[model samples]
Target: MRTEAIEAWTQLYAAVGLLAVICASCAALKTIVELRGGTVAFPHATWTQKFLWFPRLWLRFQLAYMSGFPCIMGIALLYAHYIGFAAFNPS
Candidate 1:
C-alpha cells in the first residue's frame, strides 16, 4: 500500500511538473519574442480573461527577461522537489 501510494504520487508529480514546465516554456518563448522586438498580443482587457491560463499562474503574465525564465524554472523545480519529498519516504 505504501509503495503504491508513492508510485501514484510520483506519477502525479511528473504530470504536474510536465504541464508547468510546458506552460513556462511557452511563456519563455513569448518572452524571447518580446525581447527581439516582436510584440505578443495580450488579447484580453478583463483581468480574468487575461489570467485564464490556470488559476493564478504568474507565468500566464509577461515577466521581464531578467526574471522570467529563471523564475519560472525555479518555481517548477521547487514544486517538483517538494512533491517528490511528500510523495516518497515510506511512512
Candidate 2:
C-alpha cells in the first residue's frame, strides 16, 4: 500500500513537472522569437526581413542551443532519480 502510494505520488509529481517544463519552453520560444523581432506577416514584412525560414531557424536554434534542452533534461533526470529511489526501496 505504501509502495503504491509512493508510485502514485511520483507519477503525479512527474506530470506536474512535465506541464511546467512545457509551459516554460513555450515562454522561452516566444521570448526568443520576440527578441529576434519575428512578427506575424498579415500582409507584408514591408521593412523587416521577409524570409519565413529565418524565424523558423531562429526558434530551432534557440531550442537546440539555448537552455531549453538542459532544463528539460534536468527535470527528466530528477524524476528518474526519484523513481530509482522508489524502485530500490519497495517497502
Candidate 3:
C-alpha cells in the first residue's frame, strides 16, 4: 500500500515536471522569436495586428501564463493527492 502511494506520487510529479518544462520552453521560444523581430503568427490577422500594435501584448501573455501555471500546479497536486489516497484506501 505504501509503495503504491509512492508510485502514484512519483508519476504525478513526473507529469507535472514535464508540463513545467514544456511551458518554460514555449515562453523561451516566444522571447527568442520576439527578440529577433519576427512576428508570432496568429490564426487570425486581426489578432496578429492587435499583438503587434499593443507591444505589451506579449507581456500580458507572459503574465497570464505565469498566473495560470500555479493554478494548474495546484489542481494537479490536489488530483494527485486524491488519487494516491484512493489507492491506499479503496472502498
Candidate 4:
C-alpha cells in the first residue's frame, strides 16, 4: 500500500544522503592534504605551495563539490521517487 511506498522512498533517500556525505568528505580531505605543503625528500607538487595554494585548492574543491551537488540531488530524488512508486504498486 501507500505505507510500503513511503518506506521504500525513505530508504532510497537515506542511501543517497549517505553517498553524498562520503563523496563530500573524501573531496574535502584530499583538498586538505593537497593544501598542506612541505618537503625535503618528497617530490614537490605544484599544488602544495605557499599561502596562495590553500585558497586555490579550496576554491577548486568547492567548485567541484558544487558542480556535483545538482547531479547527486537529482539522482537521489529520482531514486526516491522510483522506489516509492515501486513499493506501492505491487502490480
> TM-score for model 3?
0.51
lDDT of 3 at 17: 78
- lDDT winner, 2 or 3: 3
Q: Residue 79 of candidate 4: its Cα lDDT? A: 75
How far in Å is the alpha carbon of 40 misplaced in model 2?
Answer: 14
- Among all windows of 10 consecutive residues in model 4, the one with the lowest summed lDDT is 37-46
* Candidate 4 colliding pairs: none
lDDT of 1 by residue, 48-84 (tens): 7777634333453444333455655676567657566
Query: What are the per-residue Cα lDDT tens digits for candidate 3 across 2-87?
Result: 77766776777787877777777777666666656756443336776765654665674586458559756876878777775676
List TM-score per model, in order: 0.40, 0.39, 0.51, 0.51
lDDT of each residue in 1-91, candidate 4, tens digit only:
4667667756876878887887788677766665574321233365455646556666768875777787788887777666655574533
Q: Which ten residues in a row have the lowest lDDT in candidate 1?
A: 53-62
Instruction: Give candidate 3 regions above 4 Å deviation.
Output: 38-85, 88-91
Worst 10 residues of 2 by lDDT: 40-49
Candidate lDDT scores, in order, read 0.59, 0.61, 0.66, 0.67
Ranking by lDDT: 4, 3, 2, 1
Error of 3 at 5 (Å): 0.4
Off by over 4 Å in 2: 38-91
TM-score of 4: 0.51
